[model samples]
Target: MLFNIINNVRIICAKIVQIAKSGHPGMPLGISDLFSILWFYFYKINFLNINSINKDKLIISNGHGVLIQYVLLYYSNIYNFNDIINFRKFNSKTPGHPEKNEIIDASTGPLGQGVGIGVGIGIKNKINSFIFNKKINIINNKIWIINGDGCMMEGVSYETTSLCGVYKINNIILIYDSNNISIDGLIVTYFNENIRMRFTSLNWNIIGPVSGHSYYNIFKAYKLSLKSYFPTLIIFNTIIGFISPCKSYNEVVHGSIFNKNEFNFIIKNYCIKYIFKKKILIDNKIKYFKYFIFFYKKKYFELIRILNFIIPKINYIYIYTKNRYNCINKSTRFVSSVLLKNIFILPEITGGSADLSASNLTKNDFIGFFKKKKRYRYIKYGIREFGMSVINYGINLTKTGINFCSTFLVFMSYMYSSFRNFCISKIKNIFIFTHDSFLIGEDGPSHQPVEHLKSLRIIPRIIVFRPYNFIEVIICWNIALKLKKNIVCIILSRQNFINNEIKFYNVKNIIKGGYFVLNKKKNDLIIVSCGADLEICFICSKYLNKYFLINIFSIYSSNLLNKQKKNFKNIFINKKILFIESSNDNSILKYKSLYTFILGINKFGKSSNTKELLKYYNITKKNIIKICLYIIKKKF
Candidate 1:
C-alpha cells in the first residue's frame, strides 16, 4: 500500500514537471520515498487547528526542485489539484522556486538560503523554549531542511551548519538528497568535498547514507532524529531521475521537460494499478499526518497582532522622545545603540552582530552571547555576514520582536543575496548597517563604503531608513518597531562630532519622510540630503544663503518619500535644486524631470582623516556651495 501511493505520487511529480515545461522532476522523483515516509508518516501536522504556532518548519534549500514540495502539499490536502497544475505559472501558489508562506515554510529560491533560514528557525524555537517553556521544552518543534547537491555546494550551508554546531541547536533535521547529479550534470568534478566529514566536524550528528528508495529506512532516520544532541543531517543516497526510462539517474531529468516518448514511456512503465490520475487515495497513516505551519498566512497575520509591542514599546519609545537630550550631538549609530539597548529588554527583541559587536554596538550589557547554555538575547555570530543575515531572518519568522543583526555597511554587499530574498518576502527583519559612507576614515577605500548606500537604497520593497540625525534615529527605530510587513535596514554612521543640537518639535513632520530642515527664509536654491551627511547640507545651505534663499530638504526614508509622490515631486518641480550625499547616492537623479544638480561622490575614497576625504571627494560644504552657486549663476 505504501509502495502503491509512493509510486503514484512519483509519477504525478514527474508529470507536473513535464506539464509545466519548467520544473525539476529529478528531486521529487528521487526523494519521493523519503518525502512520503517523512511527511505522510513521521511529520506531525495538525489539520484541525492549523494555526498552531509551535509547528515544524520545512525549508527546502535547493529551490529549483520546488515541485517536489508542491507534490507533498497536494497529497496532504493543503493544496488541491488546481494549485499543483498551475505550477510555475503567473500568480500561482507554487512558483518555479517555492516562496515562504504559511504552509510553505521558508521562501526558498536562492541556493542554501533555506538551510540558513532553517538554522534560524531552530534558533528561534530554542529561544522560545528557553523563554516560555522553562525546563519543560514545550516549543521543541523541528526545522526540517530538504537540500540537494547544489545546496551543499553553496557557502551559506557551510556557514549555517557551523553555527548550528556552536549553538548545539537541536530540533533541526537536514535531509541531504544526495542525487550525485545537478542541472549541470554530475557534481563529481566540482563538488568533491567530503560532506559527511564536513558536517561531522561541524558538530552535527549524521543519520544517513540511508537508501532513499526505501521507505522504512527513511522512517528509521526520522525516528533517530528525535534524540539528537545537536542538529542532525540525514544524507539519503538517492537517484536523481529514479524511474524515467532513458532519463533515470541523469541530469536530463533535473530541470528539463521530458520528450514525447520519454513522457509516454514513464506513464506506461510506472502506474499504480494502471490509474494515472491527479487525485489518489493514499492510506490512513498518510491521511492522519497533518501538522501546523507557523503563521505565514496573510489573513491570519492581519487577525494576529504583536500586542506585546503595541502596549509597551511605542510608549517605551515615547520616553526617549520626551527626554530629547538622549540624542544630543551623538552619532546615529551611538544613538540607535542607546535605543536598541532599551528595546532589547523585551524578550522578543533579539539582536546580534557579525563579530563586530563592539563596533556595531548591537550586543547590549545584559545581552551576552547565545551559546550552548542559551542564557542571553544576543547571538555572537563570528564574522559570517550572510549567515548572520539569513539566521536573523529566520528569527524574524518567529514574529516575536523586530529581530536585528549588524555588520559594517561595506560588508552589506556580501549579505545582498539573502537580504534581497527577505525583501522579496517582506520579512520584518531589521538589519543595522553602520559606518555608512566614506566618512569612516583611516580605513582605506577597502573599508570605506562608497556605493553601498545607493546599492542598499535600490533593493525593491526594502525600507532603507537612512536617519539624517540622532533624533531621526530615535524616530526610525520607533517606526521600525511598529512596521508590520517590511524588511528594514537602518543605516547609521561610525564617525561622531558635537554640533549644536537641532530638534524636530513635531514628530509628525519628521515621519512625513521628506521635510524641510532649514526653511525659515523664502527658498531660491534647494539642497536635498539624507542620513550621515546632513551636516554638510546644513553648512552648504547656510553658506549658499548669502547669494540666494536656501531651502535644505532632508529625506529620512526615501521609500516613505516615494510614496508621497505628489508632495515629493512638487518640491523639485522646475526648482533650482542641488542634492548632496557623501557616497554615490544622488537623490536628485530620481527627480530627473526637475533638472537637479548633484554634489555626490561617484569615485572611491582615499585613506585619510574624514576631513581630507570629504575635501578629496568634493563632498564638503565648499563643494556643495560651489555647485549651488553654479546653479544660481546659470539661473536654470
Candidate 2:
C-alpha cells in the first residue's frame, strides 16, 4: 500500500508540474515515500471533520515542493482530483503554496517561516494541553514539518530550533529532506555544516540519515519519534530526482519540468505498471468521521463553557478613564502599559517582550513570566524577534488565546519576513512596537525609525495606528481587542503626551481612523498629523489661527481613513493641507490633493535631546507654523 501510494503521488506530481510548465518536482519525487507514510499511517486526520481539535497538523516548510502536499491531500479526499489538474492556476485552493483553511493552517513558501510557524503551533497545543490538565486524549496532536536544505540554512530555523529545545517543546518531529542538492548544484558547494551536531547542540534528538524511500526504516524512525519527550529532528538522504529517467538526481530537476517525451516514457514504464486502478480505499474513514462528529459536538459545548471563564468581564470605561492612574503627561508606551495591564487581566492574553519589556513598557505585575511555570501568563521571548512574531501567529491559530509581543520599532526590520507572512495570512495578533519615530532622544540613528511607519502601512490587510493621546490609545486598544480577523500594530512613542482637550474630541469618531479633533468652523489651512506630531499640530494650529483660520485633523490610522467612503472625502480633500509628521511623510503623500506640502524627517536623526532633534529636523511647532504660513502664501 505504501509503495502504491508513493507511485501514485509521483505520477500525479509529475503530471501537475509537466502540465503547468513550472514548479519544483524534484522534492515531490524524492520525498513521496516519506509523505506517503506520514499522511496515511502516522497522521490521524479526518478530511471531512474540519472542526475537530484532534486533527494533527502537517506543515510543508519548504513550500516550493508543495505539489507533494497537494497530491497527498487529494489522495486523502480533502480535495477533488479535478483541483489537482488546476494546480498553480488563479483562484484555485491548490495554489503553488499551501494556504491556511480546512487542510493546512500555515501558508508557507518563503523558507524558514514554516518551520518557525510549526514550532509556534507546537507551543500553542502544549499550552492548551496544559490548561486541560495534560489530557492527551482531549486536544493532543503533533506539529510535523518537512523542510529542505534551504529551511535549515535560514537563521530563523536555527532560532526556532534553539527555542524549542530550551523550552523542551514536545510532539514536534522535523523531517530534514537531505538530498544534498540545491538549485546551484550540490548543497556542499555552499552549505557543508554537520546538521546532526548542530541539532544535537540545540538538544534535539537526531534519528537517522536513513534512506528516504525505505518504508520500513521511515516507519520505524517515526515510531521512535512518537515516544520521545522532546522535539526530534529526523534526517533522510535521498536522490534529488529519484524516479525521473533522464534528470534523476540532477540539480536542474530541482525546479525544472521534464519534457513531454521524458514524462511519457517514465509514466509508461513505472506508473502504468505499478499504479492502482481504483481510488485508494480507507476502510476506517466512516468510523473516524462518526467519532469526530460526536467529538466536535461535545467539544463545542466544552469550548463555550471555557470561554465563559476566559472572556473579559470588565467595565472598559472605568478601566480607561476612572482608574487611569498614570500621569496625564505619559509616554505612549507608558499608556500602552496601562492598557496592557487591563488586557493581561483577561485569561486569554499570553505573551511578553523580546527582552525589551522594561524599555518597551510591556512589564506587568499582574502576570509572571511563563518560564517553566505553566500557571504564568507572560512568555520571555528573549530578543528573538522573528521567532516571537511567528510564535504569536501560532498561538492565535489555537483559537484559544489573544497573543501579543512587543519590541522596539527600529527592530521590526529583523522580523520583516515573518511580518510579511503575518499580513499575508491575516493572523490575528496584537504587535505593539514602542520607541516610534526619532524621539527616543540619545539612542541615535540606529534606534530611530524613519521609514518603518510607511513600510508597515503599505501592507494590504494590516491595521497600523499611531495614537496621539490617551483617548486614542484606549480607542486603539479596544479596536485591537475586537479584531479577530486581521493584525493590528500600535506604534508608540518615547515622548510624553497630554491632551486635556481629549474630552472635547469626539471619542466615538476616532474609530473612523481619522477625525477632526479641533475643527470648529470653515478654515483656510487644514493641519493633518498623528502621533506626537499631533501635539505640534495643536500648537501650530493655535498660533496659525491668529493669522488665518485653521482646522486641526488628527489621523489615528491613515490606512483606516483611506478605507472610508466617498462622503468621508469631503472633510480633507481640495483644501490646502499641511501634513506634519516626525517620521517619513510617504503615508500622507498617497492622498494627492492639490495644494499640499509635507514636513517630515526624511534623513537619519542625530544623537541629541528631543527639542534639538525636533529643531534639527524642522519638526517643531514653530517650524510647522512657518511651513503652514508658506503653504498658505503659495496657495493664495
Candidate 3:
C-alpha cells in the first residue's frame, strides 16, 4: 500500500511538471518515500482540523518543489489530485510556491524565509505551551520545514538555526533535501561545508544522511527527531530527478520540465504497469474539506475578535527612535522594559535584536533571559538583520497581536527586501531602528545611512514617522498600534527636545498620510522633514525668526502634499521652501519646485562625537541658520 501510494505521488509530480513546464521535479521524485513516511506514519494531522491550534505545522521552504507537497496533501485526503494538476495555474489553490492562505504554510522563493519563519513558529509554540499549560498544548504542534541545499546555504538559515538551538526548540524538525544540485550547478561547487557538524555546533541534534528512497530510514529518523530534546536536522541524500532517465542527478533537471521522451521514461520507470494515467477521483473529500474550512474560518474570525479584545486590555507599549536625539531620555527603552515586565498578558509580543539590543536600548531590564520558561521577552537574533525582519513578520503572521524587531539604521539595508515584503503583506508590526544617520559618530561611513531615509520613503502605503522626542515616540507608538498599513516609525538616539505643549491628535491622521505640525505664518518656504531631522527645520525656523526675519512652516509628512491639492499649494506657495534634514535631501525633492532647498548629509561621515559629526557634516544649528540666511538674502 505504501509503495502504491508513493508511485501515485510520483505520477502526480510528473503530471504537474508536464503542465507547469517550469518547476522543481527533482525532490518530489527523489524524496516521495520520505514524505510518505512523514504523512502516513510519523505525522498526525486531522484533515478536518487543518487550523486546529494543536495541529502540526509543515513548511516547504524550497517552495519550487511545491508539487511534492501538493501530491502528498492530495493522497493524504487533505486536497484533491486536480489541485496538484492545476499547479502554477491562475487562481488555483496550489500556486508556483506555497502561499500562506493557499497552503498550510507560507513559502519564500527568495530562500531562507521559510526556515526563519519556522523558528519563529517554534518560539511561538513554546510561549503558547507555557502560557496555556494543560488548557492548550500549543507546543505539542511540531514544526516541520523541508528545505533544499540552496535554502540551507542562505545566511538566514544559519542565523535562525543558531537561534533555534539557543531557544532549545525541541519540536522543530528541519528536513534537508541534500540532492547536491542547485539551479547553477552542483551545490558542492559553492557550498562544501560540513553541514551536520555546523548544525551540531549550534546544539542541534543531527539525525541522518538517510536514503531518500527508503521509507524505513526516513520513518526512523523522524521518530528519533521527535524524541530528541533539541531541534533536529535530518539530511536526505538523493539524486535530482531520481526516476527520469536522461536527467537523474543532473543540475539541468533542477528547475525545468522534462521533454516527452524523458517524461515517458520517468512514467515507465516509476508508474505501475497497469496504470498509465489515472483519472482524478471526484470524491466528496473536497466538499467535506470545504465545509470544514467554512467552519474553521468562522472559528478563526471569532478567535481573532476575542484576541483583539484581550490585546487592548493587556498593557503593552512600544518605544522607538528614528533620530539620534530621542535616545537621550532612554524613556522609550524604559517603557518597552515596563511592557516586558508583564510577561503573562504581553506574551505574544516578542522583542528581538539584530545583535544590537544593548546598543539600540532594546534590552528590557526585567526580562533577563528567555532560556527558562516564561522568563524573558528579548530574542537575540544574532547578526542576521534580514532573518530578524522576516521572523518578526512571521511572528505577526501567527496572528499574535503585537511583535517588534530592531537593529541599527545601517542594518536596515540588509533587511530591506524582507521588510518591503512585510509591508506589502500588510503585517501590523513595529520596527525600532537606532543609530539613524551620519550623526551616529565613531562607527564611520559603514555605519551611516545617507540614502536609507529616502529609500524607505518610496515604499508605498507605509507610514514613516520620525519622532523628535520621547513624547513623540510615545505618540508614534499610539499611532502605530492603530495602523493597518506598513509603517516604519523612525526615532532619534540623540538630542531630547521635550514638547510638553504639543497636542497629539488621534492617530487617525497618520493613516491620512500626513498632517500639519506647526501653523506658522504662511511663507514661501515650508521646512519639510521627518525623524530627528524635523528638529533641524524647527531650529532653522527659530534662527530665521531671530535673525533672517523669514517665515518657516513645518510639514510633517511629504506624502500628504501629493494627495491634497490645496494643502500642497498652501504649504509651498510663492516662497523659498528650504528643507532641513539630517539624512538624504532627495526625500523633499519629490515635491519639486515647491521652492525647496534641501540641506542634508550627502555623504558618509567619519567616527566622532554626535556634536562633532553634526558640525562636520554642516547639520548644526549655525550651518542651518547660514543656509536660511543665504536663502533669505538671495530672495531679497
Root-mean-square deviation of each candidate, in angstroms?
4.6, 3.3, 5.7
Candidates ranked by TM-score: 2, 1, 3
Candidate 2 segments exceeding 4 Å error: 134-136, 268-302, 305-314, 592-594
Candidate 3 residue 323 Cα shift, in angstroms, is: 20
Work out how many backbone clashes candidate 1 has.
5
Give the best candidate by TM-score: 2
Kindly indicate the candidate among 1 and 3 with the higher lDDT.
1
Worst lDDT 10-window in candidate 3: 275-284
**lDDT at 520, model 2:** 67
- Which candidate achieves the best lDDT against the true structure? 2
What digit string (tens of lDDT, one per residue) describes model 2 on residues 26-71? Answer: 9999998888787777887665565556577788788888888778
The estimated TM-scores of all candidates read 0.92, 0.93, 0.84
Higher-scoring candidate on TM-score, 2 or 3: 2
